[model samples]
Target chain A: MRLSIENLYHTYGKGLAFETAALKDVSFTIEEGEFVSFIGSTGCGKSTLAQHLNGLLKPDSGRVLVDGKDINEKTPEAMALRHRIGLVFQYPEYQLFEETVLKDVMFGPKNLGCSEEDALRRSRGALSLVSIDPDIFGQRSPFELSGGQKRRVAIAGVLAMEPELLILDEPTAGLDPQGHDEILDMVLALRKNPKLSIVMISHNMADVVELSDKILLLSHGELLKLGTPQEVFGDAELMARSGILPPPAASFVRRLAEKNSFFSSLSPALTTEAAAEEIAKALQGKFE
Target chain B: MENIIEVKNITFSYPESEEDAPAEPTLKDLSLDIRNGEFVAIVGPNGSGKSTLAKCLNALLLPEEGKVCVAGMDTSDEDLIWKIRSQVGMVFQNPDNQLVSSVVEDDVAFGPENLGVDPAEIRRRVDEALKAVNMYDNRRKGPHQLSGGQKQRVAIAGVLAMQSSCMIFDEPTAMLDPSGRAEIIDVICDLHRQGKTIVLITHFMEEAAKADRIVVLKDGQLAMEGTPLEVFAREDRLREMKLVLPFAIELADQLKARGIELPKDIVTEEDLMAALESLTAGRKTAGEAVPCA
Candidate 1:
C-alpha cells in the first residue's frame, strides 16, 4: 500500500504555559516495498512523524493517507488501518508479557480477532522469520532468554500482525553489535517480501546510510532534507548543523577531498566497503 | 603510580530465582589493578560481567571468593564500605533513575548532604560540580526538562559533588544518542584531565579507544587487557569475543586486505586519515577537482 503524509503539523502542550511545536509542515511519501529512514538529533520530531503514519497521533493540521484514504477519519475502517501498519517502539522487549514465548507472540494475532489456529500459524511463522526456533523457544519463558533473544521475540510479536508496513523506532538501541546486526538483518530479510514496506527511525548513521533508499532529515520539528542517502550525506555542512555527522566512511571521504584534490570526485562514501573501493580506485591508476 | 582500585581474583555469582536452572557465576577469577589518575575502559559483549565488575569496584557487590580494595580500603569490611564508596563514585546507565531531586542543583546537592557535609560546604560543592559539568546555567531547571545530555551532565554533577577521587561509568552513554554520548565522553575526559581516575565500561569500541588502557572480558574472565593499540591489533581475538572493531580499524583492515599499505597499528580515525594522506599525497591533482553532486 502507498502511504503519504502531507503538510503535517503537531504540537505538544498546546495552550499550556510551555507550548512547543514538535512537528511542522512535514511531508513525505513511502511507496510499497520502499525502505525509508528518518534521522536527526534527539527530540527532533522523528518519532512524532512516525506516530502519524498509523494514526497513533493525529496531526493538528494536514493529513495522513493510506492508499489515498485519510487514516485520521473517525470510522471503523480507519481504525482498522492501524493493523496494516505495525510500530515496534524503542526497547520493545519491555512490552513482552506472557508465560510462554508462543503465547506472547500469539497476542497480536489473537487481539486482531484471528482464530486460534490462524493465530498459532501466524505466530510460528513470525517466530521463524526472526530465526527463533519455535520448538526450542515456544515453551520457554521470554524473561529467561538473553537480551538479543528477548528483542527478537518482541519483534516477532509485531510481525504476527502481518503488517504490510513495519515501522521500528530505534530497534537496536542498547543492543550489542551482534544484536544490532541481527535486527538489521531481520528487517532486510523481511523487505524481500513484495508486500512489505519498511520505515525505520534511527540514530546510527552508518546503518541508515547502508540500508535506506530514501532518508528524511528532521530538525526542531521541521523537515530539513529529504533525499537519497548519497544526497543527504553528501551535504556535510547541513548534516553538521543538525548536530550529526555523516557515517565515518562519508566523513573520511570529505576529509580526503579537502587534502587531495584528486579525491574530491568521490565526496560522499557512505559505507566502509564503498570507501575502500574508492580509495583503491583512486590509488590504482596513479602513484604506483 | 599508586593503585586506586584493585581486584584480586574475584569470583561472583547471582542468586537463583524461580526459574528452573543452575545459577552460573557472572565473574570468575577476575583480577585487575586500576592506577590512580588512569583512564581504563572495560569492554565486553552482553552478559560478560562488565556491570558486575563495576558493582564490585564500589562495594555494591562484594566478591564471594576474593576482595576488592578502593584507595587502600577493603570493600568486604562492613564498616569501610561507605568510605570505599565515597572514594569511587559511580554513574550508571540511566540518567532519570539517578536524578533524585526535581531541581538540578538540589539533585547535585543531595550527594554531599547525604555525606553529612557542612551546609556551607554543600553549597560550594554543588556550585563547583554544576559548573564543572557545564550545567550551572540550568541549575534551577527541573531534571525532566533538560535534554538527555544535559540530564546526564546533571547526574555526573551529582557524583562529582561527593568529592570522589575516582569515577566509574557503567555504560553511561548506552541510553544516549551520538550527540549525547559525545557530551558525556567530553565530561569524562575533562574529569580525567583534572586528575580523577576513570573506569569506563562501554560496548562502543570507538569510545574505548580513547582510554589509556582497555580490558576485554569474555565469559566473566579477562580475555585481553592492554592499551587500545595493543588490544585492537588483536582483531581475531576481539572478533571471536563478539566485539566489533572501531570503524577506522575495520576500514583500514579492509583496505589492507585489498592491497593498501596501511600500518598495522591504525586504530583511531586520525591514524587512518594520516596513513591515507601519506599514501595518496604523491597523486594530488594540479587543478581544482570537481565536487560530488
Candidate 2:
C-alpha cells in the first residue's frame, strides 16, 4: 500500500487546560516495500504518528491516505482499508489472551471475518514466517513461552491479517541482544516479499541505520527531516538539534575527525564494519 | 568493603501448574556477593534468569533451596522482610507501573509514608530524592505529564525516598528513548558515586560497561564474572551465550582481526579512542621521519 500523511495534526486533551499538540504539520509517505523508521527523543510524537497511520487515532487537521483514499472516512471501504495497515504496539505480548498460541494468532483474522479454515492457514503461515514452528508452539499457552517467543507470537497475530504495511513500535524493546537480532532478521526476511512494506519505531540508531530505507525524524511534534539514513545521519547539526545521537560508529568517526584533520575528510560510516574498515585503512601505513 | 547483599547456593523454581511435572529451576545454585558501594551489572539473553535473580535479591521471589541476606537480615525471616525491602529498593522495566501517586512528590513520598515515617521526615526525604534525580522542579506535575525518562527518574526518586542503600534496577531504560536511556544511566551513575550499592540488570552492554564488575548469566547459572575488560575479552564465549560485546569492544575486535594494533584491555569507548589517538600520534611522527611520497 502507498501510505501518505499530509499535514497531520493531533492534539491530546483538546480544549482542556492540559491540551498539547502531539503531532504538528507532519507529512511523509511510505512507498510500497519501503522500510521506513521513525525516531526521536521520548514524548516527540513518534507513537502518536504511528497510531494515526493505522487510523487508531484520528488526526485533528490532516489526512492519512492509504492508496490515495482517506483511511479515516466513515465508510465500509475505509474501515477495510484500515485493516490492511496493522499496528503491533509496544509490549504487544501483553495483548495475548488466548488458550493457545495458534488461537491467539488467529484472533485477528477471525475478527476480520475470515473462515476458520482460512484463519488457521493464515495463522500457521504467520507463525512460520516469524520462525516459530506451529507444530510445536501452536498447542502451548501463549503465556508459557519465553519473552522473545511471546513477542514473536504477538507479532504473528498482526501478520495473520496479512497487512500490506506493518507498523512496529519498538518491537525489540526489552529484549536481549539475540532476541533483538532475531526480530530485525525477521523484518529483513519479511522485506523479501516485494508487496510488504514495514515501518519501525526504534531507539536503537544502529539498527535504524542498518534497516531503514527512509527515516522520519520528529522533534517536539514537528517533522524535522525525512530522508534516507545517510542523508539523515550525515548532518551532525541536525542530529544534535533533534537530541538524538548518531549511530555509535558514526559518532566515533565524528569524534576521530574532530581530533585529526586527516580523519576529518572521511565520511562517517554508519555500520561498525564500515567504520572499522575506514579506521584500518587510515592506519594501514603505521601497522605495516 | 563489606558485602551489602549476599546470595548463597540459591536454587529457585516456580510452582508447576501441572500436577505430574515439576517446573524447571529458574536460578540454579547461584552464589554472589555485592560489596558496599559497588556497581554490578548482570547480563544474559532472554529467559536466562536475570530477572529471576533480581527478584531473589530483594525477596520479591524467595529461593526455594537457599538463602538471600540483605545487610545481615535474612530474606526468609518474616520479621525482617520489610526491613530488607527498605534496605534494597528495586526499579522495574516499566516506569508507568511502578508509580502510585498522581503527583511526582507524592509518588516519591509513598514509600516512606507506607513505612509510617514521621510526616516531617517524609517531606524532607521526598524533596531530597526528587532533587537527586533532578526532578525536583517537576514535583507538582502529574505523573502523566512527565516523559518516559522523567517518569523513570520519578520512579528512582520513589526508591531513593525510602533511603535504600542498595538499588536493583531491572532493565529500567528498556522502555526509554536513547536520550532517556542516557538520562536514566546518568542518574544511576550519580547514585552509585554517592556510595549506593547498585545491582543493574540490563540487556544493553554499553550500560553494563560502566559498572564496576560484570556478571554473565546463562541457563540460570553464572556463566562468567569479572571486570568489564576481563569479561569482554572473551568474545567467543560471550557470543556463545548470545550476548553482544559493547560497541567499542566489538569494534576493537573487528579492528584487531584486521591487524590493527589495539590493546586487549580496551572495553569502554574512551579507552578505544585513546588507543586510536595514540596510534595516530605514532603514525604522524613516522610520516615526518620517512617523508612518504
Candidate 3:
C-alpha cells in the first residue's frame, strides 16, 4: 500500500488544561513495499503516528492517504482500512491471551470473519513465515514460549491478518541480542513479500542505518528531517543537535576528519565496510 | 571488598503443565558471588535463566536446591527473609508495574514505610533518594505525569529510599527507549560509585560491557564469568550462546580483518576512537599510502 501523510497535526487532552500537541505538521510518504523507519527520542509522538496509520487515532488536522484514499473518512471503505494495516505494539507478546499458539495467531483472521479452516491455514502460513515450526509450537500456550518465541508468535498473529501495511512500534525493544537479530531477520524476510510494506518506529539508530529504505526523523512533535539512511545519518552536526547518533562508523569518520586536514576529503560513511575504506585511506595517507 | 550476595549451587524449576513434556529447569547448579560496591552484569539469551537467578538473590524465589546468602543472612531462613530483602532492593523491567502510589514521593516512601521506619526517617529518606536520582523536583508530581525515563528513575529512587546496600535490577531498561535505558544505567552506575553493590541482569551487550564484571549464562548454567573484556573475548562461545558482540568490538574485528593494527583490548567506543587516533597519528609521521577499499 502507498501511504501519503500530509500536514498531520495531533494534540493530546485537547481543550484541557494540560493539552499538548504531540505531532505538528508532520508529513511524509511511504511507497509500496518500502521499509520506512521512524526515529526520535522517547515521547516524540512516534507511537502516536503509528496509531494513525491504522486509523486508531484520527488526526486533529491533516490527512493520511492510503493508496490515494483518505483513511479518516466516515465510510465503509475507511472502516475496512483497519484490516488493511496491522499494528504490532512494543512488547506485543503481553497481549497474547490464548490457550495455544495456533489459536492466538488465528485470533486476528478469525476476528475478521474468516472461516475456521481459512484462519487455520493463514495461521499456519504465518507461523512458518516467522520460522516457528507449527508442529512444535502450535499446540503450546504462548505463555510457555520463551521471550523471543512469544514475540514471534505475537507478530505471527498480526501477519495472519494479511496486512498490506505492517506498522511495528519498537518490535525489538526488550529482546536479547540474539532475540533482537531473530526479530530483525524475520522482518527483513517479510520484505520479500511484494504485497507488504513496513513502517517501523525504532530507537536503535544502528538498526535504522542497516535496514531502512527511508527514514523519518521526529523531534519534539516536528518532522525534523526525512531522507535515506545516508542522507539522514551523514550530517553529524544535525544528528547531534537532534539527539540522535549516527552509526559508529559515521561518527568515527567525522571525528577523524576533524582531527586531521588530510582526512577532510573523505566522505562520511554509514556502514562498517564503507568506513573501513576511508580509515584505510587515512592510514596510508591516500587522501583524495 | 566483601561478598554481599553468595549463591551456592542453586537450582530452580517451575511446575509442569499438561500441554507438553516437562520443561527443563530454569536454573541449574548455578553459583556466583557478588562483591560489595561492585557493578556486576548478568547477560544471556532468553530462557538462559538470567531472570530466575535475579529472583533468587533476595529470596523472591527459594532455590529448589542449595542456598542464597545475602549480606551473611541465608535467604532460605524465613525469619531472615525480611532483613535480606531490606538490604538488597530490587528494580524490575517495567517501571509501571512496580510503582504503586499516585504521587512520586509517596511511592518512594512506600518501601521505607513498609519496613516500619518512623515517619520522620521515611520523609528524610524519601527526600534523599529522590535527590539522588535527580527526581527531587518531580517528587510532588503524579507517577503518570513523568516520562518513561523519569518513572524508571523514580523506581530507582524508591529502592534507594529503602536504604539497601545492594540493588538487583532485572532487565530494568527492557521496556524503555534508548534514552530511558541510559537514564536508568546512569542512576545505577552512580549508585555503584556510592559504594552500593549492583547486580544488573540485562540483555544489552553495551550495558553489560560497562559493568566491572560480566557473567554469561547459557541454558541455566554459568557459562562464563570475568571482566567484560575477558568474557567478551570468547567470540566463539558467545556466538554459541546466541549473544552478539558489542558494536565497538564488532567494528574493531572488522577493521582488524582488513589488516588494521588495532589493540586487541579495544572494546568500548572510546577505545576504538583512541586506537584509530593513535594509528592515524603514526600514518601522519610515516607518510605511507594506504590501500583504499
Candidate 4:
C-alpha cells in the first residue's frame, strides 16, 4: 500500500492553554511495497504521523491517503483500510492479555471476524512468522514466558491479522543484543518479500540503513528530508543540522573518507557490508 | 586497593521464585569489587541476572546464599537497607515507574527526606542534586511535562540527593532515544568522575565500551570480564555469548575477515575512522603510494 500524508497537522488540547502542536504541516509518502523509515529526534512527531495512517490519530488539519484514497472518507472502505494497516505499538508485549499465547496471537484475526478455525490457523502461521514454536509455547500463558518471548508473541498477534502494511513503533526497544537482532532480522525479511510496506519509527540508524528504501527525516514535527538512505546519510552537514545522528556506520565511513580521499570517493557506502566490500577492494588493489 | 563496593560469592532470587530452583541460585556465586569513582558496565542478554545483581546491590532483594557489601555495609543486614540504598543510589530501567513525586524538586527532596534529613538540609541537597544532573532549571516542572531523558535525569537527581557514594543504573538507556541515552551516559560518567562508584547494567555494547570495566554475564554466571578492548577483542566469544558489539567494531571485524589491515579494538565511529586514516596516511607519506584498485 502507498501511504500519503498531505498537509497534516496534529495539535493536542486545541483551543486550550495547554495547546501544543505536536505535528505541524508534516507531509510525506511511502510508495507501494517500499520500506520507509521515519527518523527524528524525540517529540519530532514520528509516532504522530504513524498513528495518522490507522485513524488512531486524526489530523487537526489536512489528510492521510492510502492508495490515493483519503482515509477520512467516512466510508466503510475507510474503516476496512484501517484494518489493512497494522500498527504495532512500542512494548507490544505489555498489551498482551490473553490466557494463552495461542489465544493472544489469534486475538486480532478473531476480532477481524475470522472463523475460529481460520483464526487458529493464522495464529499458528504467525507464531512461526516470529520464529516461535506454536506447539509448545502457544499453549502456555504469555506471562510465563521471558521478556523477549512476550514481545514475539505480541508481534505474532499483529502478524496473524495479516495486514499489507506493518507499522512498528520502536519494536526493538528494551531488547538485548540477540533479541534486538532477531527483531531486526524479522523486519528485514519482511521487507524482502516485495509485498509488505513498512513504516518503522526507529532510533537505531543501523536498522534504517539495512531496511529502509527511503528515509523521511522529521524535525520538530516537520518534514526535514526525504530521500534514499544513501542520499540522506551522505549529507553529514544536513544530519547535524536536523539534530539527527547518522547511523554509526555511515558516520564512521564518512569520517574515514575525510581522512583519506579513497573512502570519501566511495561516498555513500553506509552499511557494514558495503564498507567491508570497499575496503577489501582497496586492499586487493594494494597487494596487486 | 580501596573498593567502595564488594560482592563476596553473592547469590539472589526473588522471594516468590525462591523455590522454583532451590538447588541453584537464580544469580550464581558472582563476586566483584568496584573501586570508588569507577564507571563499570555490566552487560548480558536478557535474563542473564544483571537487573537482579543491581537490585541485590541496593538490598531491594537480599542474597539467598552469600553477601553484598555496599560501602562496607552488608546488604543482609535489614537495618542497613536505607543506609545501603542511600549509599548506593539506584536508577531503574523505567523512570516513569520509579519517580514517586510529581514535581522535579520534590522528587529530589523525597530521597533526602526519606533518610531523615532536616528540611533545610533536604532543600540544599535537592538543589545540589538537580544541578548535578543539569535539571535544576526544571525544578518546578512537572515530571509528566519533561521529556523521557529529562525525566530520567530527574530520577538520577533524586538518587543523587541521597548523596550516594555509589550509583547503579539498570538498563537506563533501554527506553530512551539516542540523544536521551547519550545524556544519561554523560550524567552517569559525570557522577562517576565526582568520586562516586558507578555500575551500569546495559545491553548496548557502545555504552559498555565507555566503561572502565566490562563484565559479560551468561546463564547466571560471569562469562567474560575485562576492559572494553579486552572483552570485544574476542569477536567469536562475544558472538557466541549472544552479545552484539558496536557497529564500528563489527564493521572493523568484517574488514579484518576480508584480510584488511585495521585495528580490532575499534569501539566507536571516530576511532575506526582515525585508524583507517592512519592506515592510509603512512602509505601516502611513503616514497610512492599504492595506486587505487
Q: Which candidate gets the maximum TM-score versus the true structure?
A: 1
| Predicted structure 2: lDDT | 0.91
Model 1 chain A: worst 10 consecutive residues (lDDT sum): A279-288
A-chain TM-score in candidate 2? 0.97
Candidate 2 local lDDT, B97-216, one digit each (tens): 999999899999999999999999999999999999999999999998888899999999999999999999999999888888999999999999999999999999999999999999
- Sliding window of 10 residues with minimal summed lDDT for model 3 chain B: B282-291
Which portions of model 2 show Cα errors greater than 4 Å?
A260-262, A285-288, B19-22, B282-293
Model 3: residue B153 alpha-carbon error in angstroms: 0.9
Indicate the worst ten consecutive residues by lDDT in candidate 2 chain A. Answer: A259-268
| After superposition, candidate 4 runs with Cα above 4 Å error | A258-266, A277-288, B15-24, B262-274, B280-293
* Model 1 error, position B17 (Å): 2.0
Native contact fraction (fnat) of model 1: 0.46
DockQ of each: 0.46, 0.50, 0.46, 0.53
Local accuracy of candidate 1 as per-residue lDDT tens digits, A1-288: 899999999999999998999999988889999999999998999898888899899899999999988899999899887679999888999999999999999999999999999999999999999999999999999999988889999999999999989999998888988888888898888878888999999989988987898999999999999899988988878887887778888888888778666666663688999898887767664534
Best by DockQ: 4
True contacts kept of each: 0.46, 0.48, 0.41, 0.60
List the global CA lDDT of all models: 0.90, 0.91, 0.88, 0.85
Of 3 and 4, the candidate ahead on TM-score is 3
TM-score head-to-head 2 vs 3, winner: 2
- The interface root-mean-square deviation of each model, in the order shown, is 6.1, 3.7, 5.2, 4.2
Order of candidates by TM-score, top first?
1, 2, 3, 4
